[model samples]
Target: MKDTGSAQDAEHEVTMLKVISDLDADLNNVVKFHERVDMSLYDLLEQREWEHHPLHEIRPVAKQGLGVLHTDIKPDNIMFVNMKDQPLRVKLIDFGLAKMASQVELGMEIQPCGYRAPEICLGLPFSKAVDVWGVGCVLAFLYLAQNLFSFKCEYQMVFII
Candidate 1:
């Protein structure tokens, strides 16, 4: 039974690796598109095409835009393959809390505690920068092998409120 569990884990790792590789390839394509078109983030934000848009309004942009900004990036949401060696590949999972945004807005509701940025913490509207902040938290966890935020109580309230 133990061996079976190990085998399953190994298979899961392989699957995650493939997913990460595909994600990396997709990101590269997005980067190339940005370079070729010379579209700046500032320009995207100022387009005025998405003001007062719901979170779903930005999904199309995220699908066609410059990167998969996992807004809820966290250690538990990311799976690392072959971590014992160098060049470890990571697969990001769980988009339940993800929101695609081109510009920062005020009064936008988003972010989880610990991984949440100050803007989000302050209840300000967020942009793709929120995802960058989450990624930073994930990286810190990877390097430290521990959680970036250590909340003892009211953790769920943080996400709910």
Candidate 2:
């Protein structure tokens, strides 16, 4: 006989989807559908003028000025914090691939292909400078309104850079 567990799982997923749809439809103005703010830097840059800010705001460095590296520094990971009655601020997030400078080894995979620094792509030892390079790429993307290196593979990204 066929496995009944998968059938039950599919039924459960459908039920969950229906519940979520009902909740989405019943939400009030405070939680209206399609009202989510596009907080990502990539999206915000499309509608607003470029803001001049210090690199320290990105927080690529670790606590106490330790040499920590936010290996993945794409625009999607950066967010704009719009505070009521306060100036707009930026927050860098998604440190899932972060590592200390001393921990990174040669040829270790880190950043996304589009944002990968030259040193990392060349299989050389790297440090926080890689994060700086990533920031530069992101800044170029913001000013140009497109990705500087939109490649599917590291080889293509390095070749273009």
Candidate 3:
């Protein structure tokens, strides 16, 4: 006999990253970290030229890619599971807020409370880095056992603005 939920959970678990590869961002005319921060840091990325990249020929949403962005990456979505006779493995769960990395705009709000990334918080166009940022927040929580930027609400997360 086999367990049904185990099989379902195995299929349902969201892999942290389906693939891993070395990647680099355009630096010649980067959005300049400070520049992005300088803009209305409190506005949603979609409200501004969030796609302002260094490439003059390529618009932000031009080259649609195959990567998936998990905009909502709270601690509850990550968990460690141990299967019988198998080593324990950590996995990311939930795809409710997942979106194509190349999506120009989403009707639904991205990210949740304290786990929101800077780009998401500012309504700035974002990429895979948003997921990385969320994971970094998770790592910080695991390391320190406390929320880094504890906020009662998403609107309350304006540390810069």
Q: Tell me, by TM-score, which candidate is best.
A: 2
How do all models score by TM-score? Answer: 0.46, 0.62, 0.52
Candidate 3, run of 10 with poorest lDDT:
28-37
- C-alpha displacement of 34 in model 1, angstroms? 27
1-161 in candidate 3: lDDT tens per residue?
A: 99998776554333322221222212111121222112211121223334332333122212222256767676565433333332223334455456656554834467776777877777776677767677666555544455667547666666732
Report the poorest 10 consecutive residues by lDDT, candidate 2.
24-33
RMSD of 2: 11.4
Better of 1 and 3 by lDDT: 3
lDDT per residue for candidate 1 within 1-161, as digits (tens), equals: 36887676566555434444445534432221112232322222234342332444223223222243445555455433333451223334444443335433577655556677767666765667777676666555444444457433235435543
Give candidate 1 regions above 4 Å deviation: 1-69, 81-87, 102-105, 152-161
Model 2: colliding residue pairs = none
Model 2, 86-112: lDDT tens per residue?
233445555446675667899998898
Provide C-alpha RMSD values for all models, in order: 15.6, 11.4, 16.3
Residue 99 alpha-carbon offset, candidate 1, angstroms: 2.0
Which regions in candidate 2 have their CA more than 4 angstroms from the true location? 1-38, 46-66, 83-88
Q: Which of the predicted structures, 2 or 3, would earn the higher TM-score when compared with the native?
A: 2
